[model samples]
Target chain A: MVYELYYWPGIQGRGEFVRLALEEGGAKYIDIALKPENRGGGVPAMNKFLEGPRVPHPPFAPPFLKVGKQLIGQTSNILLYLGGPLKLAPRDEAGKLWVHQLQLTVADLVVEAHDTHHPIAAGLYYKDQKAAAKRRAEDFREHRIPKFFNYFEKVLTRNRTAGPWLVGRRVTYADLSLAQVVAGIRYAFPKASTKALRKHPRLMKLHDAVFERPRIKRYAESGRRLAFNNDDLFRNYPELDG
Target chain B: MVYELYYWPGIQGRGEFVRLALEEGGAKYIDIALKPENRGGGVPAMNKFLEGPRVPHPPFAPPFLKVGKQLIGQTSNILLYLGGPLKLAPRDEAGKLWVHQLQLTVADLVVEAHDTHHPIAAGLYYKDQKAAAKRRAEDFREHRIPKFFNYFEKVLTRNRTAGPWLVGRRVTYADLSLAQVVAGIRYAFPKASTKALRKHPRLMKLHDAVFERPRIKRYAESGRRLAFNNDDLFRNYPELDG
Candidate 1:
């Protein structure tokens, strides 16, 4: 059976991680929220799980996955569920834990990236919090971008035995997610990300390699693939970027 | 062999969640960073695993668990590892995933609580970002606290078959973490938390019940249980609180 994936139609947000993995794995799944509400999908269908009585395991928020009878939520958690079957993680217990650790760190960076524009509140508009956003974005683009990239770069450098992959020789979900991070950073802070990448060739190389993977490359060109925009988690505001 | 848990000595931070599990389970483990440096068990010992040559599995940060030769990081990841052995998680796969989902949500709240005082960056001091923090804290206190609690409250109400615990009648690591989250919030935003708790009796009762557990109670009063302070994730900044 084709799995069901639910997320906001307009933004990649956390859902893109799951979508990338699914796309890479060529996994049979439906992007439920991307469908029209008239077809019994989209935000209204997703809300049923949020507010409906039948959903004993209602997600705190979306990008939730429905595999058979199970409903899984949380980006990292969902990635974990997909990683095994998708071969996006290692087979060993230790490797799984390590990959998960890397993924969790990626998640940490993702949240910080989101906070750059929405430092005060996710509910408020960027204009309302521009002052705070400026400071937050600077801190993010400066201290955080380097720190996180440095950490990943270190992880990549240290794991030579496993090749260029974050955890192993194989392209796991972490690499795919890293590709997204790099793209998001470049899109949102072109100048700063360009400056940051100038000294981090290994990171740039990994992002390029992940993007070039046949399935991912094909998906990127596919009409199903959405472009990064102001409405998404990684919004490009000229004033906010360094 | 006993597990070797490493974290910064000064703060409860993320390590406290792991500490509570080991303490409650009466598990044989050494809180490495908490020990005196003279005995080769302080930050130096922890740093070895982080930066030293001996560690093939260097952690990004502390609160890592070393079991035999394996190293695990991330609070929720470590708990997910310890849950089964500690009998703090359900036996079924679905139940375990559900428990983990709850734990991740608690982690989300923990990060938000920390950000209330340091919204600009963790690299920056609270005083440096007080203006942003006040705004962030107000948002957290007014919007996030209720939204998060309301979701959990709904989960608790929905999962009545499991009894009072978040996952089931059994107290999982999530409950322990929830207990910590409550304590941290109360310590940081006593007035706001008090007001919030007035409307969240179920959450308050869960917090109290977890704290009152014989093992947890003994551990809390033990001298090893550090008091919440400014250095910790949840600091009582009067200006930031509602």
Candidate 2:
């Protein structure tokens, strides 16, 4: 069965994590929001599961995946479901949890990165909370980014496997997600990310390695992979960037 | 085997979520941070996992559970790991994912609630960011709280099973987490949470029901359950309350 991904159109946002994994896994899936209206696409089609009274498991927000009749919500949760099936996660229970743990950490980092631009409120525009955004972004760039990057670098350093992957030797969804987060943060804060990442060679190598994968590289160059924009989570606000 | 929990000693914080589930499950576990220094408890003990160079799966932060040799990090991940063995989650895969999705949503709400006070930076003092906190709290009280509470209430309303729980007729970890979130939010923003919760009776009832469980009630009344304070994620700042 083809996986149906429901997310806001025009921006990669959180859905990009799932898209990247799906692309690498060679899974048949449809970006529901990007499809034409008649074929069951657009915001309204996605909203039906959210707004529909009968929906068994209504997602609170976008970036949900519909597999068969099940609607999996939350970015990390969606990745957890797809990880095993898509062969991007470990087969053992402990290994799977470890990969999922890493993904959840990436999720945490993403939330913090998003908040750097929209500190006060997601509903409020960045312009409305630019002052708070500046302060938040400063802390994010100086303290948070280094701390997170250091943690990931350490994880890669501690991996006993011969390969550069976070868990065992082969690539996991966590690696893909970590690369996405790195790319997004770098896009949002080129100067700050560059300096912070300077101390994280393993993380940088992993980021480049993930993107260099054949499927991921093709998908990245493919017109379907949306470019980073102000409207997305990782907005490149010059003033917010150090 | 007794589960070893590693978190800061003073605050209920995220560890409380895991504690509640352990209590409800009647599982053997130790609050490692609360124990005396001689018995391998306290902040240093918790820090070893985080700071140690050889830790295989280093947790990004505390509230990690050590079951045997494996260290499970992330509150939701810890709950997800425990949910099955503790019999607090569903037996089926889809049911488990649905419950986990709900827990992740609660996790998102908790972050937003915490940010209402520290909109600028978690490392910064609340007093330093009081102006931004006020603005963030206002939006949280007026918009975020109601939206989250309403979404949860909708989940309870749509649970096809004839029960008060979010999944089937049994109480899942998501129900426990949702209750904890409501209680924490109510403590943080009494005025706002009370007002927002008024529009969602099912959520209010669910919160009350989860706390009223015999094990949960006993554990909560026990001094073991730390009192809500400013140092915790949910702080009762009257000025920040609507």
Candidate 3:
């Protein structure tokens, strides 16, 4: 059965994490919003999910997946569900839990990154709160980026598996998500990420390894991989970047 | 074996959710941070969890639980782990996933609440970012709270069980977290939550039911349940509280 993913169409926002997993796993799925003739494209679909009748198990926000009758939401939770079936998570319970904890941490970093651009209100335009955005961006760049990178670096260096993947000997969704994060940081704050990467060799190596994976390489090379832009979470504002 | 919970000493903050679970389940555990004579008791332990490196899997933030050799972090993840063994989660995979999604959504709301005060930087003083805080709080109160509450209201109303709990018949961690969210909203935005709760009868009923539980009732009556304060996530700032 083909998985139906519902997210904003244009930019690779939070949904990109799920997109990356599907792409790397070579799983058959439809980016519902991006498909032409789908009146229930991004905005409409997101509204349907939000404003529609109360689901017995409601998802708070977008990037939810529907496979048959099962609708799964929350980026990390969705990824956790797919991890096992799509071969994106570890088999062992302990390993799976650890990977999940790492994903939750990544989700925290993503929220922080998004907030840097919209410090005042997500509903309000970025232009309206540029000054506040600058301040928040600085804190994110100086404190959060380094802190998160250092943690990921520690995990990569400390992994006893002696492999490039975050868990066990195989590639997991954590690696894919990490790659996307690294890519976003590079696009949004090139200078900061480059400097931070110098001290996180293992992390950089993992990023490079993920980039070179046969499936990941094909996904990136293909036109399917969305480029980072101002509309998405990791937006580039020179004033915000140090 | 008793569970060992490490979190900040004074504030109920994020740790209260875990405390509620332990209390409701009648589980034996040590709140290392709250104990006296252990260098301010739990605070030191919480700090050690934050700063210590000996542990293989270190938590990015506090409210982490240590069960034997396993160290679980993230409020929802901790609850997910405990929910199963402690009979807090549902039996089936679909039910478990649904509970997790609910917990994660609650986590998102929690982050939004924290951002209201620390709109600029988590490391900076709230006073320093009063202007931004005002703007953020406006958005949170005017937009976010209603949206989140409505979604949850729908969830409770749509439950097949038509019961007070979030999932099936049992009281899962999602229910506990939802109760906390309701209490936090009431504490932080009394006028708004009171108005909002009227529109969400199911949610209000669930909140009342959770509070009425014997274990939860005793826990709340006890001094262990910390009161809302400026230092915690949901602070009552009249200027920000609409």
Candidate 4:
């Protein structure tokens, strides 16, 4: 059976990380929310699984995966489940945990990116807290992004043999998620991320290399993949970009 | 062999979640950063392991558990590793992921709590970012905390048979970490959290229940259980409290 993937339809958001795994590994899955409601899709369809009586383990938010009777949420948790089947993670337990840890850190960076646009509150609109976002973006663009870049660079430096991938010698979910992060960051903060990306050649190389992957490149070119926009996480509010 | 846990000394922080698992489960471990430098433990000791050549899997930050040559970081990551041997998580893979999802949400709340005080810059002190923090805390106090409380309350309500545990009948690491979040929130925003906590009696019960566990209660009363202070993730800065 094709796994059912639930997430908001329009944006890459966190769902893209899971999407990359399925796409790159050629897993059979349906983007449940993207389909028509009559055919058991749309927000309401996703909501049923979220709070439906059938699902004992309700997801707090979307980007949850459904297979048979089992449902899993949290981007990293879903990746962990899919990693082995997809062979996108290491075989050893320690190796799996290492990849998961890196993805969790990527999740942290994603949160920071969202905060840059919505510093005062995620519930509030960008215009409502524009000033706070401006200041917050400065810290994110200057301090936070660079700190993350440096940390990842160090991780890569420590494992030069691995080259492009963040962990070990093979491409893992961590690399896929990191590639998404670089894309989002580059889209959202073109000027700032350009300079920042330049500082880490290995990271930039990984970004280019991930995009160069036949499957990933085809998926990106395939219009099935959504583009990053102002409405999503890692939005490019020109004013917020220092 | 006793596990070597490397986290910053003098604060409960994220490490406490790991420490709670060890203390409550009665696992043998050392708080590496807390030991004297003369005896081969301190910030340097922790830093050495962070970037150490011997560690095949170097963690991005502390609160990493060192077992033989493998170093696992990230509070939840460490908890996931320790949960098995400690039997603090469920036996089934699906059940384990469920508990972990709850913990990751707890981790989200922790990040939100930390951001309330340092909305502008983590590198900057609370004193330096008080204004932005004031606005951020208001949103957190009014919207964020209640949302998280309601979500957890719903989770607990769904698993009423489990009572205070949040999962099934047994007390998993999620319950332990959640109890820490409740305590830290109460300590940081006494006025707001008190009013908020009243709405989620089940969660309040879970908080009380976890604290009342024999080993947990002993750990709390023990001088080794560090007090929550301004320097930590959940600090009671009276000015920031809404």
Candidate No. with top TM-score: 2
Best lDDT among the predictions, by candidate number: 2
Candidate 3 lDDT over residue span B108-220, tens digit each: 89888888889999999989999999989889888998989888877877787857887888999889988998898888888888888898898999999999999999988
Worst lDDT run of 10 residues, candidate 4 chain A, spans: A49-58
Candidate 4 Cα errors over 4 Å, as ranges: A160-163, B51-55, B160-162
lDDT of 2 by residue, B1-242 (tens): 79999989889899989998999999999998888888877888999999987888999998899999999999999999999999999999998999999999999998998988899999989999999999999998888888888899999989878868998999999999999999998888788777888889999999999999999999888878989888999999999996
DockQ of 1: 0.73
Query: Candidate 1, B117: how far from true, in Å?
Result: 0.7
Q: What's the i-RMS of each model?
A: 1.3, 0.6, 1.5, 1.8
For candidate 4, the docking band is medium
Local lDDT at B205 for model 1: 83
Residue pairs with clashing backbones, model 1 = none
DockQ of each: 0.73, 0.92, 0.72, 0.64
Candidate 3 lDDT (Cα, whole model)? Answer: 0.85
Q: Per-residue alpha-carbon lDDT of model 3 for A20-117, expressed as tens digits?
A: 89988889998887866466565676566666775555577888998888889999999989997898887887778888998898888888888888
Q: lDDT tens string, model 1, B47-104?
A: 8888875466677887899999899999999998999888899989788888888899
Off by over 4 Å in 3: A38-50, B37-41
Find the candidate with the highest DockQ and give its number.
Answer: 2
Native A-B contacts reproduced, model 1: 0.65
Q: Which consecutive 10 residues in model 4 chain B have the weakest lDDT in total?
A: B49-58
Model 3, residue A219: C-alpha shift (Å): 1.1
Q: What is the lDDT, from 0 to 100, of the residue B54 in candidate 1? A: 45
Segments of candidate 1 deviating more than 4 angstroms: none
**Each candidate: RMSD:** 1.4, 0.9, 1.9, 1.5
